[model samples]
Target: MKQLGSKIRGFFNTRLGFFALAVALFWAKTYWAYQTKFNLGVSGKMQNLLLVLNPLPTTILLFGVALYISGRKSYITMLIIDALTSLWLFANVLYYREFSDFMTFSLIKGSSSVSSNLSTGVMGIMRASDWLVFVDVAILILLLAFHVIRMDTRPIKKLFAVGVTLLAGLMFGSNLSMAYHDRSGLLTRTFDNNYIVKYLGLNAYTVFDGVKTAQTSATKANAKASDMNSVLVYLKKNRIDPNAQYTGVAKGKNVFIIHLESFQQFLIDYKWDGQEVTPNLNKLFHESDTLSFDNFFHQVGQGKTSDAETMMENSLFGLPEGSAMSLLGTSNTFQAAPAIMDQQGYTTAALHGGVASFWNRDNAYKSWGYDYFFSKSYYQNIKNDFLGYGIKDKLFMRQAAGYIEQLPQPFYAKLITVTNHYPYPLDKKNQSIAKTDTGDKTVDGYVQTAHYLDQAIGEFMAWLKKTGLDKTSMIVFYGDHFGISANHKDAVAQLLGKDSFDDFDNAMFQRVPLMIHMDGLKGGINHTYGGEIDVLPTIMNLLGISNKGYIQFGSDLLAANRNQTVAFRNGDFVSPTYTKIGSNYYDTKTGEQLKKLTQAQKEAVDAMTNRVTTELSLSDRVVNRDLLRFYTPNGFTKVDKSDYSYTQSKALEMLQAADDKNKTSLIDKNNGKSTMNEYKTDAPEMAGLKEFADSYSSSSSSASSSSGTTSASSSSATSDSSDKDK
Candidate 1:
């Protein structure tokens, strides 16, 4: 036994043994990650085993180079490399918990913002068991500190180390080729980061993400304004005039846009266990004043929810790849909804319960010409109210009541709900709906949270009515994107009682609810073949606004001559007659594949394909080149982003200014007191948080003064102070 122990110690103390140990530790941690942290899907046993082994060669090639150096310096280099690798793994674990995604180089570059946005609440996501990832590192450090494995003086033979690295490289190449053979285009045309990590290891994904990021940056750097000219001409030539009857239908009215997070249209009238999934939404769908579109789909790409916002606000498409909000939002100029509304004397604000920095929204909102933004910080008593991305939908809507009342009349405001987000987890106490026995927890929880969201929206609508705003305001409710992904399709098929969901069903699943309600408008379900991109132009037309001079890609959906080709970001398109997804063509009426089309049908499909490509490419050019910076619409002044800030105090500043001026501010009209008390809900969380609501109400009243001149001066002084602090 003593002889065996001595031999083991001698081997560990040698240079080659130490190199072997490093590689072994890296492989173990990577496998651990693959087994625990990542959801690589059920890609069969062989593919899953290949994914576990794929990282080994890359790990060796990366850390093996240090073997060429001599003495302690070599050891130090290996230690640094291992430490960085461990740190990267650790970061992916944390990031994946939040985004269900691995870290990209772009996200890493923006880590400072992410770190700043993180709160103590993040500690809840960290599991005590996750410390297993560091067990090997800890053991290695302890051994080195105790001199149990002293740094060997001898260097590894350079030729052997180089040969090992080259052999590993060749093996990795072969492994990747096999992966591609198993999953066609495994390395190319990957839309989801999860797919890359699924087939190739996280290390491979990081390298791939870095390459994609570099390519995007290079494209942006080389982009020119002239590249958008063709796009502009196409958009102009294809632009349709607004229907005379519908123009100015909701002119000079307040606009309340409720963004339903991860909501799909199937939930609109869906029934499960004899209970309607969205009872309130069902009522809204049938309301005489509502115009609900049954066929409107959510056309978003990688940006997802943020992309929906971009398309709705600017009538523009998201990037073909990464999130446009994160990649280009801060730099890109936009002819957005808020900016267009500003021309018509509308006060624009965006209220989201999430961190403003999540998608770089704090800066993006400024560039989008939003005069006010109420982010996560604006909500009271929310330190414990959050679930996934931000506060619960119930709490968010309840908290937004005070802020909404403060906005000036004829305002453009958006309320973004997040409780219905993916992996939808609802507290047992909050789950009023029955859970599905489909065995898919995500699908089961989706229905419950969606019901909760509907209740929240119903409460908010009631509050609008109590405040007499509902009568005068146009309420637009739309789903941002899909709640369930293709992975859950089988379970969803069972839930929907389908034999099997094919591509046709998948296409239909993309449909999201778009409802517009105004007091005097005639209501009926409109079978409009539109997407989120059409929202801006539709809203503009109803409000007596025109996008004729602006570079908009979507036409007004309400227009009699509206161009209804719903172009998706991924070069797919859907029209009333046909649905073209990638290379497949389907009859929209029958949902049957058209393997061989008539010449006229073929011509129509070809024209649409060309149009879709042009639209997407032009939108990319406009965003990539920041074309709006070079072209301003006639009679529209370019927005000075410096004029806006989303700091916590800005909400109060705006309210105070409105009070001092005794102008369009709702607070001043309400006699300097918040109308939040008028807002009522049955949310359990809200009942206990009444004191928090009262505080907001009382604070507003306390800040008001009878003397207008003195109040104006004080507000001016406060604004100046805030500016200096900035």
Candidate 2:
């Protein structure tokens, strides 16, 4: 042991040994960050290898520069380089905590206005282990100071430095080649920033982001009103006339958009061990007053849920790369649903259980003209209230009932649920059903989490009835994106009882549930092919709102002659007649590959492909160049973002100040009292918390008996048998 220690110390006396040690330490630190801090969706042995090996190339490339310097200056330069690189990583760590995305140069340049609040914001988001980011630097500095690892004063040869640079280049080339082999168009058609950092390293991703940001900036700078000409022409030509049967049916009613996170259409009627996966949702789907679409797909790219939101709100597809909400929605002008509804005398609000900064929603909602944003701070989060992404669905919905009752009548509200998110986890006490035997842990837990979300929805729906909100509101429940990724192909295939999975199966698995329910509207399952992009137009038609002057790329799905081609984010298109996956084509009905296409089939494919390509390209142009700033639809006023604040005090003040008699809030109608008692949940975490409707009514009755008089509000709080599920 003594001899080995002496030999290691002897090697540390050499310059090359010192450089090697520094590079190894940096590599280990970066890999640790990749594993612990970021959710990069690492899968497969190849990806695992890449994750371990990627940082070495970048570390060598950056630190190799110090080797060119002579004597103690080389050691100093290396330490400085190490410190700066580590600082950048730490900055991304902080940024990722808020945005769930990496720090881009564009974001940095745009953060000057918030610099004063940086200290408070940083403190709020700081984790206990965040200090570990600079621990290696401190350790090295201390070691040198204590002379435990002496800094060699020997000069390095220029030839050796040049060789090191070559080695780094070779390693990076190899990594890039492997990544491309695993996922095509990794650089040019970049989808997720996580993929970039996972396949390469943080340093490479930063450089890539810098280049993309510059390109986007240039595009926005040179954009003109004339550039919108092509987009306007395409939309006008493709616009669908609204169906008279559905048009104006929901006009003047409240709008409730319930976002079911990570939900897929297959779960609607699916069964496991003879038990329904989503019994409540299934009932909703089969209800007489619901308009359900079985062919609806969630066409989210790497942005996933945020991409779905962008499409649902603005009829604009997410960027082909990262989240549009995080990258452009904050600054871009949007003729969004909230703004249009606000102009039509409706109060607009967004309710989410997650942080306001997730996907940059706090700023984006304001840009979209939301009058109120009830984010994480608006909810009471206890120890067991949170699970995957944010607050558990049951607790979030129960708490959100109070906020919903505060919104004035004829309101447009969006409630985003996050319990059914990826890497689904549920506590033993909270899980209502058994997990699936899919072998893959992620897929197995997905079923249980989904079941929990369904129960939450059932409870909230009953609450809406108990409070009489259902009488005047139209609730729309839609899945945001797929819960299981393609990485779990074997598990998914097993669940479906299929022999194997392919691109065709993967494409079909993108279908998500879209159910719109009203009090007395005629409803049935519609098989029209559509994606999230079509939601805005479909809802607008039902609300008697004309999207004629808006530059929306989607057609009204209720229209008898509306287009049925649904475009995916990756340039794939699905139609009732055919489905295209990569370069391959298959008959939608027969599921047979089109190896030999007839002339007519070839022509049809060419035409549809052109339309899909043009639409995606135009949408990308709209977001990347911020082209909507150039035009505003008639009867619409551009939103002033400064008029809104999402703080607890400001949101409550706005709710209290609403004095319109014709559009009084639910709380006002209920004698200015809270309606939260109407909501009930079976969540074990909420045990002993007694605000359930039946219990509240029983207590009210007892009080009335003691007082010998019943107030009108108390009398109306009795349980209704009609509200119970039959």
Superposing every Cα of model 2 onto the true structure, what RMSD results? 8.3
Q: How close is candidate 2 to the true structure, as a TM-score?
A: 0.75
The whole-model C-alpha lDDT of candidate 1 against the native structure comes to 0.78
C-alpha root-mean-square deviation, each candidate: 6.1, 8.3
TM-score to native of every candidate shown: 0.78, 0.75
Query: Between which residue pairs do clashes occur in model 2?
Result: none
The best candidate in terms of TM-score:
1
On lDDT, the leading prediction is 2
lDDT of 1 by residue, 610-700 (tens): 7777778778778867777878889898888898877666556665576565455566677766676777877776667655566656654
